[model samples]
Target: MWYYTLNGQQAGPVSQAELAQMLNGSLPSDTLVWKEGMADWLPAQDVDAFRNIEATPPSQTNGSNPYAAPNSIVDENIKLSGTDEIPATPIPLDIGFCISKSWKTTIACFGAIFLTWFVYILITSIVGGVLSTIGTAIDGPVAVAPITEGMTQQAPFLPSHNQSINQQTGTGAIIAGILNNIFTMFLGLGLTLIGLNLLRGKDTNLGQLFGQSGTKLFRLIGASILYGLMVGLGLVFFIVPGIYLGMRFMFYQTVIVDKDLGVIDSLKYSSSLTRDNKWRLFFLFIINCFIVLAGALALIVGLIWALPVAWLTLLVAYLYLHDGERSLAA
Candidate 1:
């Protein structure tokens, strides 16, 4: 049996094979490992049992270690020394595995997610209703005569009833649209915080999601706006550039929400985190799009299931990338 010091505390009594599995790829190569036969603890790679096992450099992107058993790999919940942070470790993500994890997480957190959306909708509805009532009170009633059959047959070319409704609702619709975007921004931030905490294996609830996001609202907004502008500008110049930059900056929001970073710092951090993994991300994005589309095809009700699944998958990707980046830094 062998024991290892992970983060700081001693953990294990793991068998030689278990230790070898970890040393081969799971635990960092330089992790301190000790066994009964050793005089002192030494790095895993330096131990005789693991001397032949070459450590995979953190920067490697070949996806060679995809088949490692989860039980043998370092626990996803493992924290860094002196901190509660989950260290990033990039691993090959199977499409099915990603989908499955997303589905499970979405199911577990659905209640909180439902509450978050419900409140958002309620607030937006109240705001819109108030604006609508005020608009009606100021504008007075609008009356339109019903078109008779003979009149309709003679003037079939005229604008239809739907157009009338659209015309009457124009200002209110614009106001509602603005309100929806603003409210969605806040809702996104709150949900993001909730998801991040869950990913880090911390306990979080619906209330805490919104509560913690209050102080960070402006920062979130700034990061979102900056990311949008960059993507929009890239799109304006060229289609390819737009797609590339969009993928590159996709993690900006995740970084900002997770680390409370400023717009520029988050952008730079996400850019580096995603380096050499853009294609993987692209593949994941396409798969998610298809998954969502399939859900939408099912009478549009499946989006309830699909939306959360997509969100969870995205968080997994972010964590993996962030872990890899941290490992490289280490």
Candidate 2:
């Protein structure tokens, strides 16, 4: 039993959520009439003009459908989306289910990035010092400068590098940089874990989310690599295609968490969810990701604000989509 006041007349017994959607144009078949509180939905006998508010609560009584719906032939008008006939809900930026509680998760994700950078810098600095000591022997100590490069012909016995680091250029340095990339890849794992926990609306602590624990933690590392690859691939087809791809694969984290799918399956499922709702999802994505666009337009300065806002909107979209799916299933 539900009650609501529409226009000036009071009504009772309407399923609130269902009726709200009907009133909001979701139920295409229902034509609403007007009464006092419900200027939108009134019976033919009670049609009136201006609605008046009643300070008093309406009778605490439930009512049945005065006129039963006819058992007439109904049209099977709903359009199908994909081969499996899955009906994923549209996730607009303005929709409900997003939370401010997600900021911690966002922080955690970014923290992984920062932590990786710091660690890589530290390791390279240490390794550079050792090589600099070895290089000093041949140069005869004339105010020795650090061998910023990992290894070169100058230190052929040590692994030779073909890349530049700090002030050193060699094969060894490039190998160190490669190792740093690997470190960052691990950090990306941390970000994926935090993101998944955030999607679940869980109390996410960055350290805890990616703690050295089990296979799930390592799987996050793989997902992060896949995510980066997908993002790059998404950009390969042109701008609009890239944007669409981003939105289509937005559910990868959720797919991994709730569905326990592999990286490829998560990407596949996320893509499939957008089958027929591409345009709708694209338009809504504009709203949710407008901050990102704005930041891009602003160049560097806008990035500070844009990144966080875009992330929040992303969280919002994820929640809206998942909640809607749950509700529809229920």
Candidate 3:
């Protein structure tokens, strides 16, 4: 609650609560001031700022009703009332700030697999040499013995086209493919850990990102797999439920990092936090995501610059978020 007696006219005695109610946009705090040895007005903190503002006792009223204050009156609420005007804040392309960085951080974070798994890929090829591998996918048999006929379609899913799998020609390709799949399968944890490190304002080189990320790797992987299955289940209802769950647990990374929550706990905790704030958080993603798009439109070059800056900016919020924990622990 604040009061301003402007230019000795005793104009206010404005209440901060009333201002809070009236403010539809970002309200700068430095606008108010305190006066020394003066009740009416003096530049309490600075020369240009307004002064002698007093906090109206929360229980008191300044108006005739004795229950409500003067600025509590509807028309006087805004500096200009009854006007359809947007406040002077930015258009707030929310996602523009960080989505790319999240991806980049994850990419860098996951760079360790390429570093660590190359030798393993070579070893697997040598061990599996001349072995006939048969697998049932959409095709009846994706086998090493080559077949030219059209692949059989499977039940409960789409049909496979005629594609040959040959041990002789496709072996290298197949090994590379398998290794790629391994990287992708483990991607959930790698990305989240690296992204979380990025969120914590840490340098996410291949080693640290992978190492720190490994702390929550398996747990996040399981959570991601579960989230995937849940999404698949929920999407049968045209995605309403899936969307709800996504927003609800979207903060799981933060939970995992700051609170040291396990994957499942982070998911549950995020869902709880977003119970009421889902739409707002979801929209924040949509708005900030545009910056990512703009970067993509600029080609990979723009992405190189936009990605880190945007990620660091969002990390600022994450930093503030964990500050409470830091303070409490301190």
Model 2 regions more than 4 Å off: 1-175, 185-201, 212-240, 277-306, 325-330
Instruction: Judge candidate 1 against the unseen true structure and give its global Cα lDDT, from 0 to 1.
Output: 0.64
| Cα lDDT, model 2, residue 167 | 27
Ranking by TM-score: 1, 3, 2
lDDT of 1 by residue, 42-73 (tens): 77768777778765442322322222112334
Root-mean-square deviation of each candidate, in angstroms?
A: 12.2, 14.0, 14.3
lDDT of 3 at 116: 34
Residue 284 CA displacement from its true place in model 2, Å:
6.1
Runs off by more than 4 Å, candidate 3: 1-161, 164-206, 213-215, 309-330
- Which candidate, 2 or 3, has the higher TM-score? 3
lDDT of 3 by residue, 189-246 (tens): 3444554555555555445333435566556566767777777777777888877777
